[model samples]
Target chain A: MDMIRRTVLKSAGATGVVAGLLATGMLKPTLAYADDWNKAAFEAKNMDGALDGIGAKGAADNKDLLVKAPEIAENGAVVPVDVTSNIPNTTSIAFLIAKNPSPLAAQFEFSNGAVADVSVRLKFAETSIVRVVAKADGKFYSAQREVKVTAGGCGG
Target chain B: MADPMKIRAQMKGDVAEVRVLMSHAMETGTRKEADGKLVPAHHIQNMTVALNGKTVIAGQIAGSVSKNPVFGFKVKGAKAGDKVAVSWIDNKGDKRTDEAAVA
Candidate 1:
């Protein structure tokens, strides 16, 4: 707990210093880390509730995003997935596993000057809802897929 | 050892793509260990994602899933200059969350 707080504080200080420099014209130009979000607040018992908590709206009817997951997980330990979008100027990406002790599995930021892409590994407690949240132009959007696990992977 | 789930996502045009690999035992706690002790139930309850503080996608999970699951999805209407945040809380009362920016 203390360690987390210290880390947060240090990051805050660094951000403040950078902001000050930018304001004083001491720095040329660069992107900024978002300060208006918290990662621990949106967990829920189900999928829709979690989305509502994070202010995400699914574009299920939209044709811009594509998501894929295994129909049946051979083992309840590791499942692979992939998602791709044809949307222009993607700003952020993330993943979550519902049914695990922690719904939040992973997060990754993309370089503004680089392609909007991210990849990561996460732990799942069981077969659950997997969600990916994306932000573009200050708006929130997301995609979802279901995965099945066969064996016990966590304690093995 | 088995391979952990590998997940990846990319955004193009007006969509936010995402993916995940899940690692878990999904133990129902119905079985006993060698010592005859019943294992406790541990699983993920729910997960959610927000773009720029707005929740866009969510998932509901169950025990029927095998250990280590993989899932993927897409979010439409996304563009550049935004932030994506992901968070989850499990049945065991543990929670973890992280955020990424879109480009």
Candidate 2:
């Protein structure tokens, strides 16, 4: 009876594993849902090219997008940036450092009921406007704040 | 061996707040050492978060990210005891994965 019970437990565990995978839709190829990282955007030397690369070329400034960053960053090597968007259905948030060798710092895509809030530390080449662009409902909205750096982080 | 990434996932009113701290040098490849050799780019290029084996967040990060980066986000519908995992791939193809139980 003990051996039979052990076998039953093993099959139950296997069934649970299969059920979990089915419920999570893991059997499907979710790779199509994930957008590939845009290398061109990160390598763009100019803001326009970077913006165009990410399909955010004509983003309009929106008040709902809140960017929390220090007005004066004593160490350019590490600047803390917090971005929050109240716009409904936000799908992504991107960071751009105007004066960095590569203007695009990071791009984040939200899925599976993730909220539209992100925090990251970025390096700055010099004092520059830090821009946060949020995509919601297939429209791009952006807001910028100037952060003063006492020392450049990008080998200045 | 490199240190394991530190991760925390706590549920608050059906939303799991996930925070991850990864240890890396994040060299931008532009900095020169005292010997005048340029540091090769060695930063996390991709990161992803999964809840209960389902991806919730995926990100592309550049070398501008600071060394030992920290990231935080929220995932809806996660509860206490749910499995939350975080993984990252660096520019040199080094990868790390760590998991935590939502609390």
Q: Report the number of the highest-DockQ candidate.
A: 2
Instruction: Give the clashing residue pairs of candidate 2, or none.
Output: none
Off by over 4 Å in 1: A1-39, A42-54, A57-61, A152-156, B1-103
- lDDT per residue as tens, model 1, A1-156: 444434444544754654553464423211111122233333344555555555564633334656666766765455655555546665665566777654544443444243344433344567777777766666666777777766745432
Provide the TM-score for each candidate, comma-separated. 0.43, 0.83
Report, to 2 decimal places, the DockQ of model 2.
Answer: 0.34
DockQ of each model vs. true complex: 0.06, 0.34
Weakest ten-residue segment in model 2 chain B by summed lDDT: B87-96
Of all native A–B interface contacts, model 2 reproduces a fraction of 0.76
Q: Which consecutive 10 residues in model 1 chain B have the weakest lDDT in total? A: B1-10
**What shift in Å separates residue B14 of candidate 2 from its native position after superposition?**
3.3
The sequence of per-residue lDDT tens digits that candidate 2 reaches over residues A10-61 is 4337546546544644334322222255767987998888899889999999
